[model samples]
Target: MKDFITPDTGTQIGTLALQNPIMPASGTFSEDLADVFDLDVLGAHVLKTIMHGMRAGNPTPRVCDMPSGMMNAIGIPSKGIDDFRDRMLPYWAGYGAPLVVSISAHSMDEFVRLCEAVSLPGVAAIEANISCPNIEADGRAFAMRPDTTHTVIERLRGCTDLPLWAKLSPNTGEPAEVGRAAQDAGADALVVANTMLGMSIDVASRTPRLGNVMGGMSGPAIKPVALRMTYQCARACHIPVIGCGGISTLEDVLEFLIAGARAVQIGTATFQSPTIMARLVTQLRDWMAAQGVSSLGEIIGTLEIPQAADGVWA
Candidate 1:
């Protein structure tokens, strides 16, 4: 009979160590999930975006159904930082997993202020959602270009010593360029992307499906794009790239790791199966053991491209 060995699912994002690399994406995960399964069983806990002030979010029908996915323009509604620190922090403090707070802002100063406020006790790291428009930059997302990416990250970097994760926007044409800028400006890691911009329409009524007219698309449809961005940033930057978008299964997690993601965030898929993240954690371990893999790091960025006879990569 063959002896069994436990496979190591542990991974790190900069200096932060996690038991595994599977975490629920921001906005999708909440304390409610703790009732479905043990929250401490997961790799890390990522909260929804917290802003300087509370927002009501977009109008009705903020989320619209799409083929193999969904779209949302929730506008990052928040209950303000004070409420989160006073009410939510204590609830999460009891858990063993690291708590990562996601923050969004419209200007560099606001970004810095939010970082400082969220950098309180019990917080493990900060994820800056640069996908939001920068009021200082005429409504362009801070991650849309390299210069702005650097400036926003640099300012936020100074505001807090906690691990800073720059979440990039898929709307940008140059993901790699912006990723490099974030790393150079002292970002500890990168969340490869947010959802891609998309919209749906009602043919009969001649009305848009969402109240905001446009929303960010997520689910299996965006996997290819997220995978490509993860590869680009992982290749271009020194920081770890945490892949986000369309992840729902163990195979998806493996695909992200092979594309150079140190970790992955499961978003829209959670809406369908609340227990998905917890199941993946166990399945990932079993699969790795069966494949004779001993460590998660062994598979990170292990993709091999074919080469031509002339010594060029094909």
Candidate 2:
């Protein structure tokens, strides 16, 4: 029999060490998946975004299927922080993987409050879903600009000592700037990024498909855009960047790692194949062993680009 070496797939996001770099994106993962596979195989478990109060979320028909992906205006319907602490936290504690609580709020004060509340013992890290609307910014998302991103992250940092991962928005023109701001404000890592803003029309009804008229686009279609942002942010910030977008296969995961992302998050792909994340973990190990790569450090941030005619890489 041909001998194959066992590849080491461990990775770290700030001070929190992970067994592997494969983890589900916030809002796409839950405890129900435990039936499909062992959750401990994952690097981390990022729960859906929770708020201070319960939310009904967006109106019906909030999700629409696109050719290459899907759009959602879920409005972050949460059961509030109370239920998460009393119910959700314990259920997740049963799993060995590190728990990463995702939190969102409309104001800086609320964000700080939520951060403090979720900074419990079982939780390994906190992922700030700053892509949500900010009432203080005239309904604009806090991650839409650098200053707001800095303020929110800084406040969250002050409230907790747990690892802070700032999830950025892809809708902005300056992703690198926003990422740097989060880093400057003390974000331990960056989930680069959130879904892109998009809309679809129902040709038959002559009206918008989503009840909210528009929603965040995610899936294979946004992979290129997300990959670009990940590469940019990973280069711009000193902290690690966890790529999140349309990763469904080993090749996709490898591309993100080569682009400088320390890790990658699987979202819409999980809806299509619940067992995809686990399979990717196995696949990554097999691929690494076959390629004679013993560790992930050989793949992460290994992208090489030839110089342009003007002597600039870009």
lDDT of 2 by residue, 1-314 (tens): 54678899999888988999999999999888989998889999989999999999998799999988999988999999889999999999998999999999999999999999999999999999999999999999999999999999999999999999999999988999999999999999999989999999988989998988989999999999999999999889889999999899899999999999999999999999999999999999989999989999999999987665464545
Which regions of candidate 1 fall more than 4 Å away from where they truly are? 1-3, 309-314
Residue pairs with clashing backbones, model 1:
none
The prediction achieving the highest lDDT against the true structure is: 2
Q: Cα RMSD (Å) per model?
A: 1.9, 1.7
lDDT of 1 at 11: 95
Model 1: how far is 2 from its true place, Å? 6.3
- Cα error, residue 286 of model 2, in Å, equals 0.4
What Cα-based lDDT does every candidate model obtain?
Answer: 0.92, 0.94
Candidate 1 clash figure, as a count: 0
